[model samples]
Target: MSTPADPGQAEPQFILYLDGEAYEEELRLLATWVHALLLPVYAREVTSAEPWCPRWWEHQEAIARLHGLWLAWQELTDPAAGPSGPALWHRDHLGAVMHELRSPSGPFAGCKQGSHRPKAVPVVEAF
Candidate 1:
């Protein structure tokens, strides 16, 4: 997922996966968009009933899923995707991803409506 040095000069592209090996520039772009765009617009729907992790960056699975969804959103919303793109995104991406990420026992289980901060838990590495 290496970004070209002059990516701005070319067609806009994004990393669809959240691997650590993903380009630093791509990660930065995604992070900015997630913080600046996605959260502010979408997070209002998150509640005690359908919780979402405020510290979603700490969760690798959530990050990967969200990045993929974001990439699909970008692609499907473009004019080049044609009229059916939105339908495909809603059917193939949005519903499932939202369900998983907001499931009661999912990554956001600990998060509540008003208190949305997540405490990071140390990962135990198997060597």
Candidate 2:
């Protein structure tokens, strides 16, 4: 467990790690960042070879992956992170996440430009 610097302040929650309202709020904030900064700057042409889901939020894998990317973006783009921070973010975080999210066999595998396909979850036997 971690303590907040201010007694009344709540501990920050990571997006995928949150539940209920906290998850919803974080998703909204993440959507704003995704729309305002991430997509405008980094969105590439969507193609069959590199698929993208119109409703990425519906995909659990995408939510988890994007949340991680967004967290890294927040940390690495801060002024206190220094001059090479953005470069490091680009090299270390951007490429891998984007590739994973956009690859043909990714979460959006069967999705088209304006369509969102929900991926099926694998079944596991309970012990």
Q: Best by TM-score, which number?
A: 2
The lowest-lDDT stretch of 10 consecutive residues in candidate 1 is: 1-10
- For residue 4, give model 2's deviation from the true position in Å: 11
Question: Model 1 off-target regions past 4 Å?
Answer: 1-23, 113-127
Using Cα atoms with residue i matched to residue i, what is each candidate's TM-score against the true structure?
A: 0.64, 0.88
Q: Return the TM-score for candidate 2, rounded to 2 decimals.
A: 0.88
lDDT of 2 by residue, 1-127 (tens): 1123335756556676789987888899888888889888999999999998889999988988888888787777767778998999999999999999999999999899999878977899999
lDDT of 1 at 94: 83
As for candidate 1, its clashing pairs are none
| Number of the top lDDT candidate | 2
Give one digit per residue, the lDDT tens place, for model 1 in 7-102: 455544545432465555666766887888777766558776788776776666677787788778777876777899889988999888878888
